[model samples]
Target: MNQRLKTIDLARGASVFIMIIVHTLWMFATPDLQGSSLFGTVIHILGKGTASFLVAMGISMALSRRQAPWLLAKRGAQLLLLGYVMNAAKFWLPIEVFNTMPESFINAYGWQSPLNSEQLKFMLLTGDILQLAGVSLVLFAVLNIARWKTHWIATLAVAIALSSEFVRGSQFTLLPYVSDLFFANNYQVYFPVFPWISAILTGYVLGRIYQQKQKDEQYLYKVCAWLGGALLIVGAAWLAVDFKGQFGNFFHLNGGGISYLIGLNLCALALLQYLFANKSSGPITRALLYASKHVTALYVIQWVLICWLMGVFGYHTLTLWPTLYLMVLVSLLTFAVHKLYLQSKRTTIGVMQKTKRTA
Candidate 1:
C-alpha cells in the first residue's frame, strides 16, 4: 500500500526507460543500422524481455492490495481508452506521407504496409501495452470479485497462452478487430496478449506468495533465488534445445523462450529486491524509482512522443551517429515530459482544492 515497494518500482521503472531507448532506436536508426540482423535480434530480445517483466510488476502491484480489484480495473480502462485514442490518431496521418518515406524507414519502424482503411482498422484493434495491461487488469479484477481464486486465474492464463499455439486458422487478417485480441494475425499488436497475460497472471501468483512472505527477507533472497534459478535453467534448456523453431518469435508466446525470460525476470526481480531492501540507493536507482512511481503517465507520454517523432516526422538523418543522438534526445524529452506531467498534476490538484474550499 505504501511507496515502500521500491523493488517492483525499480524493475518496472528501469524497464520503461529501456523501452523508450529501444523505441528510439526503432524510430531514429538509419537504414543500415536497422538492417543489421544482429542489432535487430538483440533489440528484439532486450525489448520483449524488459516489457514482460514490466507487465509482471504491474500485476504484482495490482494484486498487492486486498481492496484493489475495481480501482485497478478503472486504471486499466483509462489505459484502454488512451491506447484507442492514440492509435486512432494514426488515421489522420495521411498514407501519402508514409509513401514518401524511404522503404528502409518504413520497414525499420514496422510501418511497411501502406496506411489505409484496413491499416486504420488494424491499428484500432492492435493491443499496445496499455490495451493489454488494461485488459489484464480488468480480467484480473473481475476474477477477483467473482471469488474465482488465484489458482483458477493462473489456470485461465495458461489456457490463454496455450491457445496461441493450438488455436487454428489465421483469422486475425480476416477478422482484424475481433481476432486481434486473442491471437496474432493481421494485427501488428505488440506484446502478444495471450502469452503475455500468462506472464502477468503468473506474476499475480508470485505477488500473492510475496504478500504472504515479504516479512521474511530470507525467503525472498534465498528460497526465491533457488526457485528462480531453477526456472532460469528450465527456460535456458528449453531455448538451447529449440532456439530457432521455438524461441524464434520473442514477441509471440514461444513456449520455450517464455520459460527462459520468465526465469530471467524472476532472477532479476529477486536481485533487485535484495539490492533495494536496504535504505540507501544509487542515483540511477533513485531516478528509476521516481519514474516507476509514474508508470502509466510515463507510458502515455512515451506513446505520444513516439507518435510525434516516428509517425509525424518519421526519420531525419539516415546516418548512424544521428540515431544515437536521437535516442539521447528522446530520453531527454521523456524526462522533460515526466516533469511537466508532475507539474500539471500538482496544478490540477491545487485548482480542485481551491474550488472545494470556495464551495
Candidate 2:
C-alpha cells in the first residue's frame, strides 16, 4: 500500500478551511470586523490562507515531481490560465459587460454593481494561488535545470525574505498590493510569488527530506516541532519589539507575519504528523484529504456561492445564523460537486479506454 502523508493533507485541509472562512468573511462580514472579537480575530489570522495555501502548494509540488521541465511548463501554463479565469468575476470581465448582462445570464450568484476592468485589475494584480503555483513550478524547473539543490533553494528563500523588508514601502510609489505583486514593493498582493516563494521552497525542502529519509528513521517530526517552536518565538519577538505587535501588519506575508504563519503551520503539521503518522484514514484525515484534493474546485465554486449570496441575499452583512447555515450548505455543495465531477471524469476516461480497445 502506498504511504499517505497525513501531515501534508492535514495542512492543505487546514489551508482550505481557512480560505473558505476568510473568503466568506471578505465577502460577507461587515467592514471594521477586524479584532472586534475573538471570532473576528480568528478570522483575521485565517485570512492569511493565501500564504498557508502557497506553502502547501510548495510541498505538493515537491512531492509530485516528474523532474521534467516540459511537463512542469505545460502544467504551469494551464494553472496560470486558470488563475486568470478565476479572476474573471473580479477583474478580467468588463464591468459594463456584466452590468449589461441580463438576469438570465447570471448564475445562482445573482447580480451586483459590477466593477470596471481597471478596478478588477487592481484587486488581482498580485495574482492568486494558481498563478503563483505556475510561477513556482516554472521556478522549480529552472532550479532543476541549474542543478540547484535544496540548500541552494533554502538560501534563495532567506534572501527573498530579507529583501521583502526593503520593499516594505521605501522602494515603490504604487499601492502595496500592486507593487508587491509585480515587484518587491511591499506586501500588497499578500500572495505575490516573491517572498512567498520561500514558503513553497521551504515546503519543497521538507518534502525532499521526507523523500530521502529512511522510512524507519523517523526524526522529522521532532525537527519540525522544534523548528516550529523556534520560529514562533522569533516571530513573536519581532512583532513585539520591531513591529510593536501591530495586529494589522501581522497579516502581511512579507515580514514577521509570514514567519508567524509558517511557524504556526509547521507546528500544526508536526502535531498532525506525530498524531496521525501511523493512522491511514480517519474522519478528520479523510475530510482534510478530500478538501485538499478538490481545493481548486472548492475555491472557485465557493466564491461563486458567496457572490450569489452577496448579490441575491445581501449576505455581505451576515448574521450568525445565516453564516452558520451558509457554511453547512456550502460544504454540502462542495461534496456533491466533487462527487459529480469525479463520476464524470471516470466516465470520460472509461469511454476513451473502451474506444482504444475497440480500435
Candidate 3:
C-alpha cells in the first residue's frame, strides 16, 4: 500500500474551505446586512487561496512524477482544458439568469459583453494554475534533461524572479493587450513566471528533501515548524510596522519582495508542520484531512455555485448574516459532492483491478 500524506490533504482542504467562505462574503456580506468589521477581516485573512492552491499543485507535480513525464504532461493538459471549460459558462450562459446583468429586455438580444481579453491573455500566460502546471511539467522535463542539477536550477529561478521584478511596469503601448499579458501591470492577472514559479521550485526542492530523508525520521518536522513560525513572526512584525504608508513601495517591490514571499511560505509551512505533528487522530484533524483530500472538487463546485448565486441575486443587497448561512450550506454541499466523487473513483479503480485479475 502507498503511504498517503494526510497533513498535505488537510492543508489543501482548509484552503478550499476558506476560499468558499471568502467568496461567499464577497458575494453576500454587506455593512447593512452583517456589519463590516468581522466580515472585512475574514476577507483579508482568507485571501491566500490562489497561493495555497499553486503550492499544492507544485507538491502534486512532484508526487505525480513517479509516473512517466508524458503521463504527467497529459494530466496537466487535461487540467488546463478543465479550467478553460469552467470559464466558458461566463460566456455561454444568459447573464440575466444569473443576475450578472440588470433586469432588462436588452439582455434578450443574446448580445454579451466582450470578455476581458487582456485578462484572458494574462491567465493563459501566468495566473491560471492549469497552464502553470503544464509549464512546470515542461520545466521539470528540461530539469530532468539536466539530470536535476540543483545549482543551475536555483540560478534559473532567481534570474527569472529578478527579471520579472525589473520588467514589472514596462509596457509597450503599441500592443497593449499582449504587453499586459507579458509585462506585470496594475492588473489582477498575476501568475507571472518570476515569483509565482519560485513557489514551484521551492516545492520541488522540498520534495527532493523528503525523498532523501529517512522514512522514520521525525525531528525534521519539529525543525521546520520552528523555522516556519519564526519566519511568520518576522514577516508579521515587518508588515505591521510598514503597513500604513508602504502600499506603493510594496506594490513596486511586487514579487521581488523576498520578505513577503518568505512570510507567506513560512506561515503555510508552519501550519503544515503543526498538523503533521498532531496527525489526524483527533476528530478535528480527521475532518480537516477528509476535507483536504477532496479540495479540488470542492473548489470547482463552490466557484460555480457562488457565481450562480451572484448572477441570480445582486451583490449590493447581500448581507453578512445570510452570507454566513449560505457559506455553510455551500461548503457542506461541496464537501458531500467531493466525497462522493472520490468514492466513485476508488470503486472504479477497484473494479478495473478485479476485471484484470479475472482475465
Q: Tens digit of lDDT per residue, candidate 3, span 1-359? A: 03344555666667777888877775556645443576667565565545555555555555553546666566656765665555554323434234364232223333334435653343234334444555566667667655765556656655655566567656678865434434545433344444566556655544444555753224434433554466456645655665432223322333324334544654666567664635547876777766666655566677667656655565545566666778898788777777787899999999999999999
**Of 1 and 3, which scores higher on TM-score?**
1
The best candidate by lDDT is 1
Q: Rate the local accuracy (lDDT) of all candidates.
A: 0.64, 0.64, 0.56
lDDT at position 110, candidate 1: 68
Off by over 4 Å in 1: 1-3, 35-43, 66-69, 89-115, 154-159, 168-176, 221-224, 274-279, 311-313
Q: Candidate 2 vs candidate 3: which has greater TM-score? A: 2
Clashing pairs in 3: 13-292, 98-311, 98-312, 99-311
lDDT of 1 by residue, 52-84 (tens): 454455445544554468787887788789888
Give the C-alpha miss distance for residue 356 in model 1, angstroms.
Answer: 4.4
| Top candidate (TM-score) | 1
The positional error of residue 217 in candidate 2, measured at the CA in angstroms, is 7.1
- TM-score for each model: 0.82, 0.82, 0.73
